[model samples]
Target: MGNDGHIAHLTGPRRPRALSPLREHLRDTFWFAPTAGLLGAVLLWWAASAVDLEIVALLQRERAYGAVRELMSIAEDAKTIVTTISAAMMTFIGVVFSISLVAVQMAGGQLTPRVVRIFVRSRITKITLTVFLATFLFSLLVLTSYESESSAREVTSVPVVQSLMTLALVGLSLVLFIAYVSSTLRLMQVGPVVDRIARETLRMLARQAPGSEDGGDGAGVRAPETGWMAHEGRAGVVRDVHVARLVRVARRQGVVLRLIPRIGDFVMPGTPVLAVHGGTPPRRALLRYTVSVGVERTFHQDLGLGLRQLSDIALRALSPAVNDPTTAVQCLDRVVQILAAVVHRPLGTVHHRDRRGAVRLTQRVPGWADLVDLGLTEVRAASVHSPQVTRRLLAGIDDLLLLAPEERREPLVRHRELLLQAVEQAVPEAADRRFASHPDRQGIG
Candidate 1:
């Protein structure tokens, strides 16, 4: 049974659409935002230059010597300022992001490689980079519109509007730079990174549709075992399934399709990706479109990914070389929080039915026990030597047991016993064993 909930029988095809490959790609890349910013900078410069020309022409026709003189002086000052901005903006972007990346790399090495994904997906980081690049490009374009022939006394035309726009961009970039630096600094810290991951995981949990209580698989309907479709492409992790489209295709074909691998599972070539029950299997191409595969796992549809990342951090922290028990305890705190949220939620196989109430698509999601194990088991094993971690692990398990239902308490109980036994075997001193045995939320404290 999947940890997400019991078998869900969802009627009709009203499920949320999964993120398409192109969108997912765009989300993960750094180039898209800067590229868009560059394009926007070009368009903005053109508009500002046009407006500046119009203002200059009006000033000349009206013979407004006072306004023209003032504007030309502003333009003269702006020329020097914009020139400096254009020259320095690129360097600012390179230096800021370069340092940020190095910090990110160090953080990744210290915690887990998966944390880098958080940095990549940060909106502030992307927006900051975009504005910085756009400011640079806009300033450069504004410089081109400067009137080289105009002397200080006889001002013909001034790039007044363009210069103002350039100044505005520069100010915006400065504000974003400060914000970006603060955000990056927080990302490097253990508390903020773990909190971010836990929050994202809980959001995914909240989005999950409630599952039915009828514990039977497919709500008493049996999946057909007639035909199957094998994956044909290069091996990749199952990122997301376009369930709405799959159900539509299944309903049309008068068949029930069961996905063989759960989300986050890697599929090698020739792996059976879909099982066709009730009728002929749909074309391989159709199945391929509905199931998105990638080289790595994403949080898009994989509910366990957040927990997996948290576990990785905990294990890394507990390693002898790092031996940061407090970091491990922090991770355990989040793990318990995630499990507490999952305890009451229904999780298991999900059944998607057509409008007629027939189960057309079925998927196995992570179960409650699976989640408890994923979040705690590995961390417990690695915490044997650290009394601080052991105490925290016991406290976390005890906390979960208080919230977990009877059926769900088994995993928590089992983990508690295993934790005690491991602590006993590893810590030979009775006083230390007693210390490790006692549950403490703060570990040592």
Candidate 2:
């Protein structure tokens, strides 16, 4: 239906389409209101600038505003002013392009606001660059150098040079952005960690419920053989998690849940939540199975949603108790695999030695290892194994691998050899791992 009480009767009474919340809110605000007020403001400014009207001259200007009017002359200069505004728009676009370059450089958690991944996927840099180029051309061709007097005062060359510099920087930024975006995409494509985890989870549930076509996608399922740890409370972070209870609905459908142990405690791979008593739960129930286990509260809501439905169906067939240690280890291995897949430079490449004889790596963020109960791998990976740079150091401080930005070249290359020695013990494999695609990979970053 149209906005102004226009009713269309076709196929059953049609409901009016409502504006989205964001659009409706914007419509009510001054920022998005109609342009009548803005046009009025522009006309008033023109009147004041044209006649040089003082507080008491409005009546006189109105009486004599027609012949040889200053307003007419000012109106003639509108083209120039609009052109200058276009140039400013160009500069804003240039900044966006520059930011795009920075974004790609830090695609893998190197930049702020982890949500930038969507921006990268949107190809915003290309659109921004196009806008910038169009604005630059318009400003250069139609805005500047419109003067008629040949004897006019000489204009400073600064603005011209600044425009050229802006174009050059934007060009360079585009090159860098393309390179980093490609690299990041390659990394994500190569790492199969997330898919592997999802598949394993489905398989585990399928085994417990035999003769059930509840695999959802009919993908072959297998229970986790290793790397699974059972814990008593929730498994992952609860802050961002979405949970719902399906016990009542599931029970009505003949779902049987055999509480394996303490009912209130969280269950891991080794512990079972319950044995299915009746009909299979829907696969959607798997979504709510996200037990808080990791140190970080990053409970994956999407992962939960996808798995829960399949879990529900599996539970009805042959609900079995969860008991597997391999699941947790598999998760850990997935982390290592993902890191290895994305890293182009050896771990040694990014390390540096400071004046205080300390090794530094800027991006030393540890993975989600605290998912297990024993916390054995988490402790080893995060604490001891991480800090130990070498079996031997100058004074027991192995070389360091600082994961700082590439822009900070001075601090990194200043003491390369010293830093290498410090990190040698910590990452012996890094030395052999070649950053480049060669026969024998070189050591750490």
Candidate closest to the true structure, highest TM-score: 1
Instruction: Provide the lDDT at 408 for model 2.
Output: 28
lDDT of 1 by residue, 1-445 (tens): 1221222444555444344555766888889998999999999988888787778778777877778778888888879999999999898888997899899999999999999999998999999999998998888888888776664346545888888898999889989988998999999999999999999888666555554445543443465577888877789999877766777788888888888888899999899888888888777666657777888887776889999999999999999899899999999899989988878877787676666666777777888878888998899899999989999999888898898888888988999999999888888999989988999999998
> Candidate 2: lDDT over CA atoms?
0.30
Q: Output the lDDT of residue 243, model 1.
A: 66
Q: Model 2 reaches what TM-score against the true structure?
A: 0.23
Which 10 consecutive positions of candidate 1 have the poorest summed lDDT? 1-10
**Full-model lDDT for every candidate:** 0.83, 0.30
Let me know the TM-score candidate 1 reaches against the reference structure: 0.89
